[model samples]
Target: MHPSFTRRHLLSASSAGFGMLALQGLFGAQSPLVTRRTHFPSKAKRVIFLFMQGGPSQVDTFDFKPALTKQHGKPVAKDSPTVFYQSPWAFKPRGQSGMLVSDLLPNIARHADDLCVINSMHTDHNAHPQAILQMNTGSFAFTRPSVGAWCVYGLGTENQNLPGFITINPEFSGGGPLKHGNAFLPAACGGTPIGHGGGGSATAPEKPLKGIELPFMKNARLKTEEQRRQLDLVQTLNRQKLAADGSNEALEGLITSAELAFNMQREMPDVMDVTKENAATQEMYGIGDGKPTDQIGRACLMARRFCEAGVRFVQVNHSFWDDHSDIFKGHPQHALETDQPVGALLTDLKQRGLLEDTLVLWGGEFGRPPLLNKNNGRDHNNVGFTMWMAGGGVKPGIRYGSTDETGARAEQDKVHLHDLHATMLHLLGLNHEQLTYRYAGRDFRLTDVYGEVKHGLIA
Candidate 1:
């Protein structure tokens, strides 16, 4: 079962990249284990959802708050409707568009041209865990099929050798697996987590994407053809059982899942390897090296690779943006960890001609308040938050929605998360109104009867 030393060396070394060519030559386009096909023509066949967990401070990050700086540490002109705490943080322009971003994100500032930042965004839940679920899945408290799951069910898979939905160690905090779980939907719709440490949403300086582990079954040295034969037998048996016994739906799903896993063993590692990348590319991704705070640089880099390999959806999360303690210490750390790499990913996609068909989204469940907390940090502000989208059918340099004087509320062009989701689905060419899943005798959808596509974001 031990891997050959040569194979091990290749697996560990990412720069050679010849492993992918080798795998393709040996297995063809189909899974070296099992290949799956897509259901429809797609404008955006893949997604990279950068989840800023713990609701980032929109006013401090992207949404400018000139008034907040003017009124810093002072009470509002009006009474405190929600809390006694007043607004916090200052904002200024970062990049050519003159779009304001905070001081925390210098690295991201370098690539501002590539980002499409949405100023006004919000959700129902203000709490961390519930809002995380609401953002990832569609509800506040319920365990439903995550967006990743729905895409898999709606479009099936373009590359069956790899998982249809891959979550590289999603946060386990508030929503945890709920952010990527497939509740009522088949288990197949749930995300295939690449690493074990991601559920924590930490940004330490280790391998940000090192925990990618395959099923124990894939640890062997058998020829891929041998596994394919075994899978074919299982698939045939399952088909007959479905035909004879009316339908063992779950078991049938298991059959498909198994075949998918077997195929993934031969393909997934190659996509994850970074050693084979040229030094310039590696520097761009910050894979082996980046500032301590921007630990998520590698995930951003890998997202591009997955999109290239035809993955339908990839959600990259860097959470704990909830800065209820110290905004000075908190905001900068998260930004440094993410900014440059995100910029690099967007640019790379554009250069590679993948941006036209790839959708990249950035944001959190909600945003922080302009008002200050006891420790100088801002609290969650679901009333008016922020999010942004790019590539796919998105209109470049377009701004949608606005916040009030203190950057405390959504004042103009209010775009809710549901609306954001609808617009994303619209860009992918699927009618949000038409894409529905029947559950509990009711038709359910990601938008959930409450969304209007933000036209300004469209190309």
Candidate 2:
């Protein structure tokens, strides 16, 4: 191969398995993995990040503020800003623990006790994109590796069958791949974003959202036997190439990626086969059976499938929540789209014994500011927000930290984004400070410069 072509192949192959497949000329030198990796052996082999993007109004979601509702139509403080919007709906207690949740998310309310609600979350950046980056990648300006990417790096992957991290239906409204990118790490560590929204993308929900078809056994095109031979030949070639270039870490990486894709072709479809799910399971995830945007429902179900299949991390985006204008329309629809399936994924995983080590994160980049705006909507608040964690060493029926009485800022037992990232890494048996990638003669880490595990939240 020409020297330039060889260099391009390295980039193209670096993403899809460590490096194992032959070039098809379609993916065209782009990486299949963009999220970072974990730093060590992991208690949770996989993660399903159920991001309620656009900063859902916490008062209307899992973070209950009775004071807000009690003082609705009037400011709790005389100096209260004019921008805070009141929730249109009343929240009621749900589930055995009776955690207060708005009626808009009744499905989610059913799982309240199982949630480890962290109400004292705060970020340095408040805008959607910056806060999102801070939440996912641990930085607002610098392009650091995302939490998913860092996890993959720290722990490698449980299943080579799927990419280390995958995002379903990420969109501009939700801040796109910046919401999931793996910066400064190898290209192999980034998230593979699957779609634009609930639907409409070549690789997303409306179109075979489970995964790109594997290297062989196509539903169309090449037959099974032919496909097998192709994989076998490719493996043989890679083996010979490795023998010739022993200790060539870059080449070995390429071989790993392609080989993984070949093996996954056979395993992923079955693991992700919703068709095999009985009607009861389907009903639990809210897939089909007349639900609107069942596409979002399907994505959440696939996240469960991927985790069960041993994929390291999966993100299912429900971004439409930037309610700059309309809370009644925005928050409810967003709630309707994600609430049941997420609750179901948690329930199903627990039923299957997967919850013990499979960590699940829910909530958004930040939260709505407390004061009401003239437009009847809320602005972003990095001062205080809520995010929850379940399973993977998280305590059950627990509430960690607390906001000041008004719930406007993190005061007691606050969990910063870096601390949250560190705590997550710690649960996976990683020393967040030790898991560093050397770049530009400096050691880079996910929780750069600051982090401490919130041990109280650990199970």
- RMSD per candidate (Å) reads 10.2, 7.2
Evaluated at residue 98, the lDDT of candidate 2 is: 72
- Model 2 segments more than 4 A misplaced: 1-43, 69-71, 75-86, 172-175, 196-253
Top-scoring candidate (lDDT) = 2
User: What does candidate 1's lDDT look like per residue over 1-459, in tens digits?
Assistant: 000111233233323444434433322232212323322344576688988788887777777766556666565445543333432334456567766666566656555655677887877889887888888887886667888887766665667677778886474235767789877655666788765321122444344444343456365766778878877898767655544443344664676678777777778877876555687886786555334433466667667777788787898877667788877777777776677778788778888999888888988898888777557677878989878877787766656788887777888988887888887777666666766665566767777878998878777
Tens-digit per-residue lDDT, 1-459, candidate 2: 211122334444545445333432312223333223444445676788888777887766766666665556675467654633356677787667776777877776777788888989988988877777777888888877888887776665656667788787666334556657766664556786665323332112344333333334344767667767886898677666654443244554565566556666677668656767788887787766346546666777788888876678898877657776767677777777677887788888889999889899998888886667667667778888888888887887777887765567888898898999988888887888877776666778889889998889987
Error of 1 at 126 (Å): 0.6
Cα-based lDDT at residue 16, candidate 1 = 47
> What is each predicted model's overall lDDT from 0 to 1?
0.68, 0.70
What's the TM-score of every candidate structure? 0.83, 0.81
